[model samples]
Each structure stands twice: as structure tokens, then as C-alpha cells.
Target: MDLHPGEQILFAGRPSWRSILGFYVLGFLGAIVVGAIVKAVDKTGSGVLAFLVIFALVLLVGFLKRIGTTYTITSERLHIRRGLLSRSVQQTKLERVQNVNTDQSLLERILQIGTVDFDTAGTDDSDFTFSGVANPDEVVAAVDRAQRLDPPAAS
Candidate 1:
């Protein structure tokens, strides 16, 4: 979606490769299992096609998800858009942001990718989380600065 006039985007990002690595791993292991089963049972490569089909499906879904999901930070708000066929968009005003956090697991820390969480002032829970973002500390800093900026209405 286009931003309103006078609004400037501070940051735009997607979930990092770390977030979707599971899908690739699943496809790989599944193909191996299918190959083993076919080797043991058919020997004609009957289930080989099944493995290819499953792998293709998983790969497609992962690609589409990575391509379709986006997290955007604007001077006025934080916006997240996700979905392939149907888009879901959520935005919280900068003035409402209560806290910004970056979370990283041991593996993620090693990979240098993390999740950025945003908690708005009135919300009991985080308004949104950008998972597996590369260099999430920078994003968190940008979000913190944005949160400190006055909202359009206030200005």
C-alpha cells in the first residue's frame, strides 16, 4: 500500500531466510524418506514423483511467503503486510508504541537473524513481531526512533 502524503518510510524488511529454513529442510528430508521408501518397496520409483511434488509445493509456499510478507516502518506508523492470495495489513501509530524488542535464539544469534517485537502503549501484548529479520538490532533502533517521533496528528 502507498503511504499517505508526507509520510516517509524509515525501514522495510521481510522475514529472513532463517525463518523459512524449516520448509527447505522438510522438503529435503521428505524427499529422502520417499526415495528410501520407493527403493525398499517399488524399485520402479513409484513414490519418487510424490516426493518431487511435495518438495515443489513446499518450495513454492516458502518462496511466496517470503516474497509476500513485508514489515514497514514509517514516520507515522508501523505496518506489516502478509499473505499470498489475500493480504493482511496491520498498522500501529508511532505514538502508540510502548516498547521495541529484539529476540534471538542461539542458532539465530549464530546466524545473525532475530525477531523484532513491537508493543504499543495500550495493548497488553506486542502489536506485531517481525520474525527472522536480519540485523534486527538496527531495525529495533529505527523503531525506537520512530516511536519517539511525534505522530502526524500530534504534530
Candidate 2:
């Protein structure tokens, strides 16, 4: 659907299975560390196994939560909705956008997914990123169009 005059979608994406697998691998490593610590303290294999299983479950839940979040861009503002338990909604007005950056890592390039980073004029850091977007170029074009259509107010 076309964005409304005052509405923009910052990002719409489905996290690749590859990305989810990567998280799982990281979780495995974390599980190993926890297992080692538990084994050192208790000298029991059950503790290690239990910790590993719990770690895997936690990572799976986290991956699911990440998949649920939506980051959007509207004509007037940027919006981020994240988390299942304690949801977070952060909005940044279009007028505050100072810079836009696009980046693709090796895996992202291979998978044709890129991230768009937005730098707000008064923010401490550029933490707003549109992750795993399929067509970053199109998004950039849209952002440019929005900026042109809505010029910032004079200081």
C-alpha cells in the first residue's frame, strides 16, 4: 500500500532463517559458558544440561520477540514498536532527521538485506536502524522524497 501523505513505513521485514540460526549459534556458545560455570561450581552434569536447555529456550523466545517488532517511518515521524511484555514505542519527528545512512554487512549483502540508520539532530547516538530491509535503495528514495516534501522549519 502507498504511504499516506503523513505516513511512512520505516521498515517491514521478515528475519531470514539464516539470521535466526546465527542467533541460535550464539546462544549455544553462551550455553556452553553457563554449562562450564555450573559444572565448575556443582560438579554435576545435570546442572550444565539444564542451563543449556534454558539458554536455548530463552534465545528462541528472544528471536521470536525480535521478529515481532515493527519499525516504521511516517511522513511526519519515525516509529519503533518493540517487545512483547513491556512494549516500547519511540517516535522521532521528520524535522529531527539530520542524516540517513545505509549499510550492508557481508552476510546482509549476500542475502540482499541492508540496514538504514537514522541520525536525529539532537539524539545522543544514531540508534534508529531499519534492520533486514529487502530493498534499501527504495527506502532511501522514499526518505529523500519525504524530506523534500516536508522541509524543516527554520531555527
Candidate 3:
């Protein structure tokens, strides 16, 4: 990530590994089932190869999705960058932040992962969020500190 002159990064991270545990688990189970069916039908050792390939593809997809997205909080703004080849960036100044919210599902709570949402003023993009982040409270604190360190300019 390139920072502007004098821009100080407060928090920067990608989705936690634990956040994608469900994907891994599901893929593993599915691979096992498929492998068993193939082995039963073919009576050959190729089932093992099929299982490995399926599991590997799942892992690769999950890894790419997780690493392709990034959340960044700087003294001046909050930014989210997504996609690898075709990049999309969303950012808003600290002064424009209208609300900060944390959302967690039951599974996410168990895994200790959550999404930190930022509602910014005067923007069409209302879905800005740090999804699947670990330790959401820390992210919130970082945002608070950034805002405090560089308070909104006086009118």
C-alpha cells in the first residue's frame, strides 16, 4: 500500500485465517465424500488424486480471496482495497465518518472474528467494512486513535 506524504498508518490487515476455517472444513468434508464415492465406483486409486485436487483448489480459492482484500486505517482516512488483478479502492476521510459498527455471527463469535463497518457521510458506498477481521475491538480502537490524533478540521 502506498501512503501519501506524511500519512501514518494506524491499522492494516487482511482477513484472519480463522475467519475462513469454515470454508476449509467444508471443503475437506466434501472432498472426503467425493473421494469415497469415486473409490467405490471405480475401485481404483485415482480417488486419492481427485480428493487432493479438490482440496487444493478449495485452499487456493480461499487463500486468494483472503489475501486479495485489505483494510487500512490511517491518521487521515479509512481505506479498503479489494481484488488482485482489477483493483477497487474505497476510502473516506476521518472527518466524514458518521458511524463505526461491529457485526458478528454466531460462528464468527466462536472463531473470534467480526466485521467492522464504517458509515461515511456523503458517499454512495454504504457497504464499506473490514470483514472477517480478528479482534474487532482493536480495529475500532485504532480508528478512534486515528481520529483523535488527527481531528477534523475546524470549519
The global C-alpha lDDT for each of the candidates, from Candidate 1 onward, is: 0.83, 0.70, 0.90
Residue-level error in angstroms, candidate 3, position 27: 1.0
Ranking by lDDT: 3, 1, 2
How well is each residue in 1-155 modelled by candidate 3, as lDDT tens digits? 67877779999999999999989999999999988888888887978988999999999999998999999999888889999988999888888998899999998988889999998888988798999999999999999998788454555
* RMSD (Cα, Å) of model 1: 2.2
Q: TM-score of every model?
A: 0.87, 0.63, 0.91
Which of candidates 2 and 3 reaches a greater lDDT? 3
Report the lDDT tens digits of candidate 2 across residue range 111-152: 777878888988885578777667677667767776777543
Q: How many backbone clashes does candidate 2 have?
A: 5
| Candidate 2 weakest ten by summed lDDT | 10-19
Superposed Cα deviation of residue 112, candidate 1 (Å): 1.3
Candidate 3: which pairs clash? none
Best-matching candidate per lDDT: 3
Residue pairs that clash (backbone atoms under 3 angstroms), model 2? 8-73, 8-74, 9-73, 10-72, 10-73
Better-scoring candidate (lDDT), 1 or 3: 3
Candidate 1, residue 24: the lDDT equals: 92
